[model samples]
Target: MRITWIALLCLSLVGCGSEGGKTGAAAEAQPEQTFSWKLVTTWPKNFPGLGLAPEHFAENVARMSNGRLKIKVFGAGQLVPAFEVFDAVSQGTAEMGHGAAYYWQGKIPASAFFTAVPFGLNAQEMNAWLHYGGGLELWRELYEPFNLVPYAGGNTGVQMAGWFNREINSMADIKGLKMRIPGLGGEVFTRAGGMSVQRSGGEIYTSMQTGEIDAAEWVGPYNDLAFGFHQIAKYYYYPGWQEPGPTLELIINKQALESLPDDLQAIVESAARAANQNMLDEYTARNNAALIELVETHGVQVKKLPDDVLAELQRISTMVVDEMAAENPLAKRITDSMRVFAKQSKAYHGISEEAYYKARGQE
Candidate 1:
C-alpha cells in the first residue's frame, strides 16, 4: 500500500509539471499585438520628396517593427483635405499626419517657428536647433494642447524665392504684386507692399494661370519642375529667404502614439528621422539636375533677387516677426529661442560653412 501511494504521488507531480510546461509553451507561442494606423498628408500622392517622405516613413515603420505596426499613407484629399491633416490627427480621425508646421499658424500663431521663420535657420542650423538646442521640447509643449505629437518629417532645404511672371528689379516692383505665400512670410510680404494670397500646392498653378496671382514660391527646382510652374512663369528667382529651411512635420495623435508598444514607438521615431534626412538628400541631388533642365530645356530664366528688394523684404520681415512675437507669449518664446540659436549658429557657420563654400566655389 505504501509503494502504490508513492507511485500515485509521483504521477500526480508529473501531470502538474506537464500542464505547467504546456501553459508556458502556449504563452510563448502567443502572437504579438499588431497595429494599423492611417497617415494623412498635405502633399499629392507620391509627389516627389514632400509626398514620398511619408510613404518612406510608413514603409520604414512597417519594416522596423517586423510587420507589427503598419501605417497607411493617404495623400492630400484622400481621407481628408490637405489643410485638415492637423485637425484629423488631433481629433483621432487619422492616427498620423504629415505637413509643414507653418500651415497651422492660424490655429497656433507660434507654430511657424517650428517649420521656418522668415530669415531664420537654414536646414543644418534648424536641424541642430531642433534636435539639440531645445527646439523640439518647445515644439512638443506647444502641441500638447492639441493632443498631437510633432516630429521633423522632412526639410526642403533652401527653397527658391518663387516663380515670377515679370522681373523684380527693385522694391517698387513688389508693390501690389499678388502672390501665393504662407506663414509669417506672407505677413512680411503684405507688409512689404505685396498681396499675399494663401493657396495650396495644387491650387497655385491654376491661380497663376488665371491671373489670380502674379508670383508664387513653391519649393525648389525639383518640385517646381514637377509642378510645371515653368510652363506658366517665365522667371525663376533664387534664395528663398522666406523659407530658409522649412521643416515639414509628422504629427501623431497623442492617444495613438501612447497606445503603441515601446519598441514600435521607437521605430516610428527612427523612421521619421530617416525620412527627414532622405528628403534633404533627395532635394539636393534632384534639384541640381532639375535646375539645369529648367534653365536649358524649359526656357526658365533663373534670376537672383536684386539686393535692394531682398533688403526691403528683410526689413519688413523683421517687423512682421516682431509683431507676431508681441501678439503671443508662446510666439515670443519660440521666436526668442530661435533668435538666440540662430545668432550662435550663424556666427559659427559664417566662418565654417560659409567660408568653406566660398573657397570651394573659388576652386
Candidate 2:
C-alpha cells in the first residue's frame, strides 16, 4: 500500500510537471503577445518611395516591438481601391491606410491644409507647423469625426508641376486645359480656368497618353520616370506650386488604435515619425540624381510655367481659397488656422530661406 501510494504521488507530480512545462512553454512561445494588422495603401505594391515606405514602416514597427506587432501591407486594389483606402480604414475593413491627406478633402475640406496648398509652406516649413504651431492638434481634431487617428507618414517634398502636351506661355493658355489633378489643387486649377480630373496614379499615365488629359502631375522626378511620362509628353514643367510640400499621412482606425496597449501605441507613433523623416531624406537624396538624369541623359525638356500663368494662378488661388472659406465652416476654420501659421512661417522663411536662395543665385 505504501509503495502504491508513493507511486501514485509520483505519477501525480509527473503529470503536474508536464502541465507546468506546457504552460511555461506556451508563455515562452507567446511573447508579451503578437498581433497582426493590415495596412492598405493608395499606391501600387512596392511602388518606389511612396509604396515602399509603408512596408518599411511595418517592418520597423515589428522589429522594434520585438514581434509584438506585425503589420502586413497591401498595395492599391489589394484590399480596396486607392481612393477607398481612407474609407476602408474608417469602416474597419482595414486597420490602417497610407496616402496623402488631401485625397480625402471631399469628405473633409479642412484636411487639405494637412497635405499641401497652392504656394503654401514647403516640406520643412510644413513639418515646423505640424510639430510646433498647433497644426497636429487641429489635424487630430479634424479626423476625430471620421474615427481616424492621423500620423505624418511621409512627404514627397515639392512635386513637379506636370508633363504637358503643349507649353503654357500665358494666362490664356490655361483656359480649357484639362489636367488630371486632385484635391485642393484641382479646385484651384478649376478656378484658374482649367479642368481637373481626379485620378489615381495607376490611371494617370494612360489618361495622359490617350490625350484624355492635357497634363498630369504626379510626384517629382523619381516617380515620373517610373510612370514613363517622358515617353509621351515632351514638355515638363517645374516648381510644383500646387503641391509644395505634399504630405502623406497614415490613417489608423480609432477602434484599432484604441485596442492597442500603451506600449504598442507608442511604437506605432514612433515608427510613423521615423518613417516620415526617412521618406523626406530619401526623396531629397534621390531627386537630385533623378533630375540630373531627366535633363542630361533622357533629353527631357525642362521649363517653367510662364510668369503670366503663375501670376494668374496665384490670384485665382487666393480667390478660390476665400470662396472655400466662405462656404465650408470646417474649411474656413482649417484655412484660418493654416493661414495664421503660414503667415508667420512665410515671414521667417522669407528672411531665411528666400534670402539665402537669392544670395546664392547672385553668387
Candidate 3:
C-alpha cells in the first residue's frame, strides 16, 4: 500500500507540473507589458488636416494594439516646439513625430525630395512612388543617419497657390513679393523674385495679419478656410505649383521602434499607413465643400494663377531641382528615381486621370 500511494503522489505531482508549464508558456505568448509613447507634431492640437492626422494615428494604434501600446500626442509647443519635432523624436524625447521632411532642410539639405518637389508628383503619384517606386527606401537611407525611421504619414493633394493680398497679374507681380512657402517650392519661389518665408502653421495667421508676409501658401481651401485666410487675404489662387503633393512624415525613433515586440511594431506600421491614406481621403472629401463656402459665403475671389507665372515658376523649379541634385550624389539618385517615375506616371495619367478629368469637366 505504501508503494502504491507513493507512485500515485509522484504521478499527481507530474500532472501539476505539466499544467504549470502550459500556463507559463501561455503567459509568455501574451504581451502584458504595456508601453506608453509620446508623439509630437508641428501642428496645433487637433487643427484640421495637418493636426488631425496624428490624432487619428494615435487612436488607430490604441484600437489595434488593444492597450498593449498607447501613444500620447502633443501638438506644437505642448511638449516641444513645432520645428523641434525632428530633434524630439531622434533623441527619444518623443517616440514619434509628424511633419514635412523639408522642415529639416537646414539640418538635411536633401530632405526636400521626401516632402515635395516643385511641380513634381501629385498626391496619387507621390503615394505610389513612396510605397512602390523605391522612394521609401531612399527616405529611410537619408534619415538613417539621424537615427530615425521615416513613414509617409500624410499627404495634402495639390494645394492652392496661396492667399495673396495683391493680385498676381503677371510675372512682374511675383517680383519682390514676400510669401510663406516651404520646401523646394520655397527655393523656387525665391529664385522667381519672391521672398520665400518660412513659418510654422500656427504662426501663419499672425505673420500674415501683421503684414510680416504679403502672401501665404498653405494647404487647400478646407484647411485654409479653417485658418480664416479669407479674412486676411482676398485673392485665393489655385494650382499649387509649389507643392503638387506634400507628403508629411511620421518619423519614429529607430531604437524605440525596434524595442517593441514584433506584433506591436507591425501595429505601428499598419496604423501609420492607414492614417496616411485617411488624411488624403478626408482632404479630398472636405476641400470641395470648404472651397464653395470660401467663394459663395465668404465672397473670396477665386483666381487662377496666370500661365506666364506658372511657366516661369516651372522653369525655375526645374533648374533648382537639377542644381540640388548636382550638389549631392544622394540627391541625384532620389531625383532620378522621382523623375523617371514621374515620366511614366505622367504618360499613363495623360490617358487616364488627366483625360478623364477633361472629359468630366466638359459635362
Which candidate ranks first by lDDT, i.e. highest? Answer: 3
lDDT of 1 by residue, 1-363 (tens): 357976787576745446554445666787999999999999999998899899999998899898999999999999999999999999999999999998998999889888888888999989999999999999999999999999999998999999999899998888999999999888888888899998889899999999999999999999999999999999999889999999999999999999998999999989989999899999988999999999999888999999888888898889888988899777788889999999999889899999999999997
Task: Find the 10 residues in a row with the least total lDDT in model 3.
Answer: 14-23
Backbone clashes in model 2: 0
Worst 10 residues of 2 by lDDT: 14-23
Top TM-score: which candidate number? 1
Candidate 2 lDDT over 1-363, as tens digits, reads 357876788576735446554555665665475689999999999999999999999999999899889999999998899999989999999899999988988888767878988888788878878888777878998899999999999998999999888888887787899998887788988878899998999999889888889999999998888888888889899779899998899999999999999999999999999999899999998988887888888889999987777877788787878877897676787778778988888788788999999999997
In Å, residue 129's CA in model 1 sits off its true spot by 0.5
| Cα lDDT, model 1, residue 303 | 95
Q: For model 2, state the Cα shift of residue 319 in Å.
A: 1.4
Residue pairs with clashing backbones, model 2: none
**Model 1, residue pairs in steric clash:** none
> What RMSD does each model have against the real structure?
3.1, 5.0, 3.1
Q: Residue 230's C-alpha lDDT in candidate 1?
A: 92
> Comparing 1 and 2 by lDDT, which wins?
1
TM-score of each: 0.94, 0.90, 0.93
lDDT values, one for every candidate: 0.91, 0.88, 0.92
Q: Which of 2 and 3 is the better model by lDDT?
A: 3
